[model samples]
Target: MRIVSLNAWGGRLHEPLMPYLVNVEADVLCLQEMVRTQGADADWLVYRDHGIELLQRANLFEELKAALPAYDAFFLPVARGDLFEGDRRFDSEFGLATFVRRTYPIIGQAAGFVHGEFSADGYGPHPRSRNAHCIRLFDYERGYPITIAHMHGLRDLEGKGDTPARRHQANALVDLIRQVKHEGDRLVVCGDFNLLPGSETFDILSSLGLADLVTSRGYEDTRTSHYKKQPRFADYMLVTSNVEVITFDPVAEPEVSDHRALLLDLK
Candidate 1:
């Protein structure tokens, strides 16, 4: 399977990213900070043109209610952030969101999108307190199937070592990982975990038997956040036990968001 994960930057994108089909896309996509209020056209366009299902909200949740009538929508309200790392708020003030392909019925749900309290602090002076989104995806139809955990955590905060919040933030996701993974079932975790390969969080996930897709292929894990020298490898496509990492690259064109798109293929 191949997956593409991005923060979406904001509610809107440039002309290039507006009609997302023109750009490289994903079979299943997870977008964060989508500021689509009720009846907004952002997700509607994806559904209209590409047939991708969406799960999100804007000023109100009415549009989500109507767009996805078959399945109930879940919201992870944006709250305060842990001050330990730093303080940065979502530009859209939205939480991480999931849009299950309408074809797949959900068997489980997360507590909410917001991991920790999000302090309304802008970046610059203090470190930015960032959290990630963890969504567990299941394919139960195949007798038994794989479980996917999608997340986007904070990266590059100055005081990461001193704070327990960053580690605690991943507790829920780690718990989800333990519960969903079984002997026969394959486990895959993707999305922007926000930590670099050498970071403690990355090591923790690795200790659990997960391998970074980019690292295994000998492809430099860089590219995602524009702030990095090269493209940063904050976004990840990791597999547990072991899975093939066929291809990984930043999209060549149809430039979607400010962050370069990372693509992954696996057997």
Candidate 2:
């Protein structure tokens, strides 16, 4: 099975991002920073916060569902706010999405907030709400169940560091994992964790017997050229020892999004 995880940057790089999503051919795709605007006819919307403005695809989630018809789509929103086109305002949801191949029978699932609960109003303060989604599927070929869970970790304006909220988020993630994964299941957890390498999030995840594939495999940069920030790492993939990892790549080419895609091929 091939699984790919990316922070899609709200599909801001629409031209390159659409084709990449279709061509990647991942059995499972986990995307963060996904946007959905209901009843909005416009193709693009703008999100403004603290003077920073970002362009987002009006409904990238539904677009991907159409583009990848073979996958079962799931969207979990952490917050709902207003997106704009000129002076018109449209209600939009922001969060994580997971697409799994239809051939894989989804036998179990779980989802919950890792930071703050769903905010119906505007996206609350920085370190806005974040949620995680987990799905368990029986891989007939592998003759065992595989559990995959992903999340867009809380984004704190102060910086990515070990803090009480982040620690609570990590524990919440582990709790969600425990709720869905079975004893013999091969476990995989991934997403744009928004965390630095030395953060305690990994220590908490390690307690669940999963190992970080990015750092352990010597991937120093996970951000694309579009992101001109320091400490380029923001995405990661973790798998249990039982998973037979055929190949893993922190794809740097194609420039699909600001954050690099983490691709893992496993048996």
Candidate 3:
């Protein structure tokens, strides 16, 4: 089985993102920073926040569903806000999404907020609401269940340091993992965690018997050339000890989004 996790950057680079989604051919795909605009006809929407303007796909969720017809897609919105098409305003949902290939039978699922609850109104402050989604699939070929969960972590304005809210978020993620995974299941957790390498989040996740594949494998950067930030590590993939990792690649080519895609293949 193969799993790919990426922060899609709201599909700002739609040209490459569209083909990447279709060509990656991952059995399971987890995406963060996805945008969905309901009842909009335009293909592009503008998102403006704190003087930062970005162009996003109007409804990327539906686009992915069309591109990968064989996958069962699931989306969990953390907040609802507005996107603009010229002067017209459209309501848009922002969150994470997971797409599983039809061959895998989804037998269990769970979702919960790791930070604040769902914001029905505009996105609040810097550290906005964040949530996680988990799905347990029965892999008949492997003869065992595989549990996969992902989240786009809370982004604090201050920095990506260890904060009280982030610590709470890590614990909440652990609880969510425990809720759906079974004893003999091969577990995988990943996403754009929005954290530093030395953060306590790794320590918290270590309690679950999962190892960080990014840092442990000596990967230094998870950001593409588009991101001009310093700490180029925001994404990670963690798996249980029992998982047979065939190959793990932090894909840096194609520059599909600002973030690099983490691809993992398992036996």
Candidate 4:
């Protein structure tokens, strides 16, 4: 099965991203930094690409649903804030989204904050509320159930180094995994972790018997055309021992978003 993960950069790269989604035949698509607005039409939201040019995506969730009609889409809001479109501000919901093919039998699902509580009134800053979205599905091709979890990790404005809250978030993530994961079930955990390699965050996840495929496979970068920072921050994809990884790629071409899409083929 082919599974893809990306931090959509708020769908700022919607123009190209739309085409990529149309042709990328993925069994499951996990995306972070997606936006959803109630009662908003296709042209309700807009983003500035690389903070230089304005871009608009009617409603990303709706657009994706149209593009991938056979996939079940789930969105869990972690932060509530306002997004500006021209001179107006609209209430926006920002969080993680997971889309699994309908052919897969989803037996269970769960979502909860891994960093902070829900910002019911409005969005907050670093250490702001963040969540992990998980789904357990029966993969008919493999004839076994696999639990997949995705998250958009805590963003620390000050730096990407270790912090107390981040450590707490890591522990919370492991806890979430333990809550829904079943015995002998294969596992996949991924997202834009906002962390560098060898940090305490990865250490915590490693304790759960997960392997960081990106670093272990000798991949050096996952940044896309939108990012222009040092250290070249990137996303990650980690899996358990039982998963037979046929192939993995942090697709650098296409420039779909600021973060490259992580594609994994499993047996």
Whole-model Cα lDDT of every candidate shown, in order = 0.49, 0.93, 0.94, 0.84
Per-model TM-score, in order, reads: 0.65, 0.99, 0.99, 0.93
What lDDT, from 0 to 1, does candidate 1 have? 0.49
Candidate 3 local lDDT, residue 169: 98
lDDT of 2: 0.93
Identify the runs in model 1 with alpha carbons over 4 angstroms from their true place: 21-25, 38-75, 80-92, 111-115, 118-143, 155-163, 224-231, 242-246
Instruction: For residues 146-166, write the lDDT of model 1, one tens digit per residue.
Output: 555666565444533423545
Clashes of each: 20, 0, 0, 1
Error of 3 at 121 (Å): 1.1
C-alpha RMSD of each candidate structure in angstroms: 8.8, 0.7, 0.7, 2.3
For candidate 1, which ten residues in a row score worst on lDDT? 81-90
Query: Candidate 2: where is the Cα deviation over 4 Å?
Result: none
